[model samples]
Target: MGCCTGRCTLIFLCTLQLLTSLERQIFDFLGYQWAPILGNFLHIIIIILGLFGTIQYRSKYIVVYSIWTALWVAWNVFIICFYLEVGGLSKDTDYMTFNISMHRSWWREHGPGCVRREVPPPTTRGLEDHAYISVTGCMVEFQYLEVMHSSLQILLALVGFVYACYVISVFTEEEDSFDFIGGLDSYTYHHSPQKTSHVQLKPVYLSK
Candidate 1:
């Protein structure tokens, strides 16, 4: 398990890289404007950190893997919340503008300037609040496929974590009867009969 830790760590790092690459492609296609230098620098830093962690803590790779997994999960939650809150600036749902518009209209209609003003769109409130757009506008909308992909990553991370825990238990537990095959041979031979000696033939030869 220790020896395989490095490979597992690399797999997780590559998954992160793939996600970032997809984000980059989406941003480029949308002609989205971001702080190119800063974004690139951050990407580089992430890669460097992953590589450093892999090299320096290969035996304890589970620690790095857990950190990365947590970060990824947190990032997903952040994206979900940001989109749901920002209305038109949502990164996931497509009907944000329409919903925001209705919300703003309702707000403006009930306000102090009701006599002279129509309701503002819901997004108008976000703009009025001067909320920071952050990195959300550049986020790719979460489609069914994207959700499935992310779900698979989360599942894989969980499986790896569980396996790591099992390995830890195996190492810590003081049991000499560690069944390597664990009844696998029994499963293979399932209902087959056991071999027996032919004692009748030996008896006949002795009588002759």
Candidate 2:
């Protein structure tokens, strides 16, 4: 297969996916976002499997990887919706953590150029005093950061899905073509098949 639409391109894409997924996993871990963490874990595993398949020219593994890419695209879309508050999904909620904790995105507190301030809360009748954190000077909002991450993931998954399908088709064609021929390379059958069955030939090419 050619490099542009072949296993080489798929391998490069999968490697890039692995790196980005690992980076996202680290931030998700810091934020204690259970859902994204789990998804990233699975994505990493499948990407490695896809990389192995690409290297070894295994069509079945590529097929599984291709299917996973489609599902991955959907997963990222859900994440984008969740972060953007589309379809009634709220970013302020702990939906990403599966309601296990109140911990929010790390970027909410430590985003680029963001400044966090703590101030006393309003007095409540017979209630304990509390302090609230105020974030300002953020170059970009946290929800947008999350959305961007998901968007990037979606883009990579779509590209990978396309390359994976092409690679699988190429693999299939190679298999079919090999079977159509007798699997012969540079050697010709000058003698009977039984006589040339052994690999202990004098030499593939004669000296004189």
Candidate 3:
């Protein structure tokens, strides 16, 4: 592999994936989106593994990473669909939180330039611990933001997958080209007969 090709490119892409996964993890944790949090955790770990495999030339690990990248792409696609409420998937559903809490995405209420206004309780009889605040004036909606994140992940995963496959092939070629026996003799560049230089040869003038 050249300085920026096969191995180097894969390593760099995996690093980028790791960073994005971490950023998504933090936001998912803040929003208490349990399912996404778990996914993000796994993504970060696998990305690290991918980086390790790329550096160490471990083909098995690279294979695992490539497989996971495919899965990650699918998972992100589902996220985009869920957020977009496509195929009758509702974002309001508590699936993200595992139905453990009513807490929603942090961006829902605190999106860019969003204002949260407290709603007056209709009755004193039934009031929850948390106040009801309506979010307004969001420059970008939370659903779109979520979709964007997923899109970016998908894009990175696709590129990473290609490079990973290339690296794996490269690793295989390296293994096949090198000979291993009980022990192999050292390589000598001059093992083949050296060519005699014309200047070092006896001149034909000697025939005169």
Candidate 4:
């Protein structure tokens, strides 16, 4: 059979279906609203291609062919961008930093940047030159949820890489088989024409 054809092709199809369904379930469990939008769209695409391969295209070669094509495309997307984790602001805050000890009026009156801007370190006199105040850091805005969501994409990308390797190995095996046959054909066709008829009928007599 051709690359990833027959049983291999069927295995790949089943795996894809299972993976897609599992992803949907996981997304739903996480209460991922965008899951339906993104996951469902990709799921539909895979179903259409798989359906075409299994029903319209009788050749398992074509089924695997479509899968390889899809895999490579997904691999590219994954390699290029999917794995990278990025951060973004979740919401805007009134001040860059907040100090619980300080009153809101004090912040508004002094101007908001860092709280230290309003309450600078005392350089002069009895405030204690050696006393250290534990200062809380800035109230930076970030989407913790987005960071978590991106982890799943990174995982899927890794899986896609493995799938690409599997498909590539299957394709290479078929290519090697074809190359071997082609080499045999090339050697015999040119060098053994006088014996070609004998060789052609040799198999029949051998089977007897």
Candidate 5:
């Protein structure tokens, strides 16, 4: 399959980031959680700026976007490190497994209580149990997926920062070469010997 255009890819990623940031901001606000409030707000702003810069293709805005993205990479590193230090990977795995088991056990105990009265107990029992297991499995899968998504975002941001730097280098090189060529032309024109059009008239003498 052919790869998507860079502009399209950037727009897609920025849209995802914008949605993620907005969701986090809303959740935190509803929960009365202020610790990450500023961070989420800043992320929203930066993502919007990046989206605008990508669409506009302006060098100044793109340069700012690149710098912000680099900072975002650093922030992700800090977040990952904090998570690791607070709860190691093994601990996180165990926590997710624990949650899955708890959900499964809860469903096993309470599933019958929530079943519809019209459905026969025997026929619905097996189906209900299977549904609970499927739900638990999905929960476990999504827990790991979140972690993978965060890592992938960090990698993408780093790649974007590098690409922006390369673009800046290409622009800088072109400008420098143009100036160098112009300087050489100017120097050659100014320093080269100038031709004089004045010719000495010599008096013609009659040859003997």
Candidate 6:
């Protein structure tokens, strides 16, 4: 039971990490006006379910968790491929400029009073540059973290898959053992011959 508790904790943490990473990516995509919100929302729900299932130790939940993990793994692989295709981090060298442009465009289109009020330009060049630099650094760090999290998620999912399989095998073995014991007892009770007591003829004659 202690072992199971520990394993559940690990799984929960891994899932939480995956959730955080996904949320971060989703937020970034949303900022850029290109996020798949519904898919990400579904992923979040699946992770939550997995966490609940792990804590409760339910096989059905574990199965769901495993399936989601598998799908997440595939999604991560696809993302990695896409990232590479886009020339990886090197292509993001102009992240600050791109992000600023995206932010401006998004705010212009969606911000409150967009039609009534004009967007304000940066007041201080030095401060603006500094802020963009900081933002760019954070973006770089986030990108690296995203890759690391994806890799870690893959490992976690693999471990979870194996654990799920083990749990299933254990249940199967227990059922088989019970069935065998039950069948053996049933056969012994029904097939074995009954013993009978022999009567003494001498005793009967004396009585007469």
Better of 4 and 5 by TM-score: 5
lDDT for each candidate structure: 0.43, 0.89, 0.86, 0.44, 0.56, 0.55
Error of 1 at 52 (Å): 4.3
Q: How well does each candidate superpose onto the true structure, as a TM-score?
A: 0.33, 0.83, 0.83, 0.32, 0.47, 0.50
lDDT of 2 by residue, 47-159 (tens): 99999999998989999999999999999999888888899988889888999899999899999999999977776545576778999999999999988998899999999
Each model's total of backbone clashes: 6, 0, 0, 0, 0, 0
- Please give the TM-score that candidate 2 achieves against the real structure: 0.83
Q: Which ten residues in a row have the lowest lDDT in candidate 2?
A: 183-192
Local accuracy of candidate 1 as per-residue lDDT tens digits, 1-208? 6635634656565456546545543532243213222333454355445445445543244455455556655544443444345444444332323333222111122223333323544466554654322122222333333344445545554554555454434433423233545566675575343322344344554554
- Tens-place lDDT digits, model 5, residues 18-87: 7766765664455333434566678678778877866765456667868888777776665555444454
**By lDDT, is 2 or 4 better?**
2
User: For model 3, what is the alpha-carbon lDDT of residue 143?
Assistant: 95
Q: Taking the tens digit of each residue's C-alpha lDDT, what string does model 6 give over 170-196? A: 545666798999999998887654322
Q: In lDDT terms, which candidate is top?
A: 2
Q: Clashing pairs in model 5?
A: none
As a TM-score, model 5 comes out at 0.47
Looking at candidate 5, the ten consecutive residues that score lowest on lDDT are: 102-111
Compose the digit string of candidate 3's lDDT tens values, residues 1-208. Answer: 3524878888889988988888888889899999999999888888988899889889899999999999999999999999999999999999999998877788898889999999766665564545668889999999999999999999999999999988898888778667552124443334323444544575666554
Model 2 residue 168 CA deviation (Å) reads: 0.3
Clashing pairs in 2: none
lDDT tens string, model 4, 90-147? 1222121232222211212222232442343568556554543332343421233223
